[model samples]
Target: MSEKRSFLLQKQNDAGKLNQSKLLKAEENARLLVTLQKKKKEVEQLRLQYKLLQAEQSAANKRIDALKQKLAEKARCKEAPRVHPINPPCLETDACLRQTAIAYLKARKQGNASALSRHFAPDCNYQYANNREVPNEMVMNNIRELWEKWPQRSYRLLKVAYRDNHVELIYIYKYADQRNHSIQGYAKEKWETNSAGQIIHWREELHPGTSPAESAGYRLVPLNIK
Candidate 1:
């Protein structure tokens, strides 16, 4: 009876050890599951962040493309051709007159009277319709006043004729005041050059009702003086 009791006690001890081992293994598996869940959450967060970054990068690229297109359009507009072009075969005697006239027009555009005066002779005569002739010195003041009165102006040549050191130009004159009052009129101008190719006589006439037909056979050509 004593031996049997001892053997039963040993069996109970073995069973307890086995149960403890099983419990420890289950606890270790639960810890591994917890660690796996945390790792999965971290991976999910990283995926979401990557998606946001990709979206932002795509938007940035689109904006860059749009800006590039806008700049290209501006460049194209800037590269558009100018209205005036340089042409050859300008008359021998009238070449200086053409250059002087173009320079005068350019000076008017820039409001530079000194530059305009370089094309005129010392004793130049400038006259308008039904008006007394003015000295060359008066030109500077007159042009200054004209530019002051008409702040915005444009002169488009319609026709030109050259003969005997004299040239005639028909042009469209556009003038605008500070009040935005604008008018466009046709005008005829005659210029006579001295031996030194300086303009000595300048005559101008304004024709609001009729256009001059004398230049019908000629196309307005640019001197390309500038």
Candidate 2:
């Protein structure tokens, strides 16, 4: 009976030791879980802070870019050209037209008539969109009349293109009488050259795209330009 009791006590003690070890293991797992949870919260906070810092940096860069742009614009404005009382020939055209225009502009600047006036052939006629024909005499007369009426009247070439002497002009014209408005127009002049490379006969068509001739030409040319 004593031997059986001793064996039973030993088994009970071993079982108690096993249970105590299991309890200790469970407590260690709980501590590790708490540490993991704390680390997770710290990572989330760092991520949020990083995102906020990135957003602030981006905003600051955008603001800096805007300021730089404004400064560049101001610098450009300060370096802008000064237009004179008698507007010069700023036309960018072929050598022939450019030379002619420059001479005309210099004469006008010196309070003289344009040298181009003598080149106008009396037989030449200009056709309008209304199919009205105006003689060279009429056109020249109108130019002189307009010039006299508005002394400050002048034209400037905004752009130029020449493909085989078909010199095209995108121009801007303004008069003192029409201070609030300016004329924006395009001119395509066909070439007729003299032996000296002077333009003898220039058939000028103004505001071409609206004309029947331009429409016909565009149809023959390309889809991209039209």
Best-matching candidate per lDDT: 1
Give the Cα-based TM-score of candidate 1 against the true structure. 0.50
TM-score of every model versus the real structure:
0.50, 0.36
User: What is the clash count for each candidate, in the order shown?
Assistant: 0, 0
Report the CA-based lDDT of candidate 2 relative to the real structure.
0.54
Candidate with best TM-score: 1
Error of 1 at 202 (Å): 1.4
Query: Which residue pairs does candidate 1 place in steric collision?
Result: none
User: Residue 126 error for model 1, in Å?
Assistant: 2.1
Q: In model 2, which regions exceed 4 Å deviation?
A: 83-226
Number of backbone clashes in candidate 2:
0
Show the lowest summed lDDT stretch of 10 residues, model 2: 217-226
lDDT of 1 at 167: 66
